[model samples]
Target: MTTEFSPRLFERDSEIRALGEGLLACALPREAWTHEAHLGACLWLLSERPDIDVDAEIGGIIRRFNESVGGVNDDTQGYHDSITRAYVAGVRLFLSETTATSLVERVNAMLLSDVGRRDWPLRFYSRELLFSVPARRGFVEPDRMPLPVAHK
Candidate 1:
């Protein structure tokens, strides 16, 4: 979880589109799976690929992609349900709030905002709670503050 982070994820709209395409195809490189890339993928999928249900299918998509990249999805490792849900919801909300003409512009704006922080979740969940086994295994209510997006 202490991975190096970049404030900016993409330089162009095509990069974001590529991220979404790579994610769905499970061809995204291991190193390319950064926090910004995660959010960027949400942008593309939600904004462009209306055929795919981003929130409903994100977990399986991420799990499959993780496995394709030789990663594990156990409680402490690959995917964390609550964190991913929060981010996807945040990205959804961001899209709803912004009027950016392109995906990359929206992603860049997000990178410059609080959501860009690697510790963005900490604003809603306690560190201990967010990284706990339950949070990793499935979605759990935040112990700190409510997420901006109303989530089940």
Candidate 2:
């Protein structure tokens, strides 16, 4: 099977990662799916559409600014080289750009949407894929803590 590589696909990968990281920052489970699983989900989305060419498919929506910028990451190669790891990095890029609340809402919408539930292979999507990603995102600070006692 030929894997199509295009600027758009990389862009989408970046978008998805951004969305995921943003949602995760607010309240995504610390351990739900593995890093590989996240990548698998995206891969399935790209390949699942038979009409669309996996390589040609745009992984994300293209933006006006990006057109002139060219090349999402300087060091990272195209999607074919490191699919999972690249996707993971996209997540961080996304987190930096957006807020957590909207991210959660978007994720919920995607999860509930029809496209999200359609059957896809689970081998990579399963918990095993977790290893592909980091356990904690630098300084696992608690979301909240009890209020400090008032001074007398």
Candidate 3:
């Protein structure tokens, strides 16, 4: 990723990480997970006018949410899992309406550009396409991509 694009992705990830850490530090019950904390974070990020400070706001929310419930694990594993799930859901919700074609185009461009860089091997990702898009000529060849294994 270029400096510009990487910052956006990192910003999103960092916000989620801080929120998770705050949750782990606070005394909260599992009920805290249902408090719409993830939605709040997503709304703030995607809002038209983001007045609140990112880290401080997310941390405060997580802490308060935890305080509302009984405290749970305050360690890396707990925080990491919560953050990952929240981030994945947020991305899916946020990007739902975006066209698959656009996603494919931008991703291909990014990959092609990065592939030529010395740092190419350091970055890797795989995503299973759960939905099908009509194949378009000159865009991508479905035959060239491996299909995801069928889940029983």
Top of the candidates by TM-score: 1
Model 1 lDDT on a 0 to 1 scale: 0.84
Tens-place lDDT per residue, model 3, 1-152, is 35432311222434444444445455434653532334433433433225644433554444455445654434321222223233333333444433433433322232234322323222221122111222110112223333222122
As a whole number from 0 to 100, the lDDT of residue 20 in candidate 3 is 48
Looking at model 3, residue 146 earns an lDDT score of: 35
Candidate 2, residues 24-121: lDDT per residue as tens digits?
23233424333333543444333233464433333332111122234342222212222333343333333333333443333333333322332221
Model 2 misplaced stretches (Cα beyond 4 Å): 1-81, 106-152
Would you list the C-alpha lDDT of every candidate in the order shown?
Answer: 0.84, 0.32, 0.35
lDDT of 3: 0.35
The pairs that clash in candidate 2 are: 4-55, 9-59, 12-59, 12-60, 17-91, 18-94, 34-129, 34-130, 35-130
TM-score between candidate 1 and the true structure: 0.90
Models sorted by TM-score, best on top:
1, 3, 2
RMSD of each: 3.3, 19.3, 17.5
Residue pairs with backbone overlap in model 3:
27-70, 27-71, 28-70, 28-71, 29-69, 29-70
lDDT of 2 at 59: 31
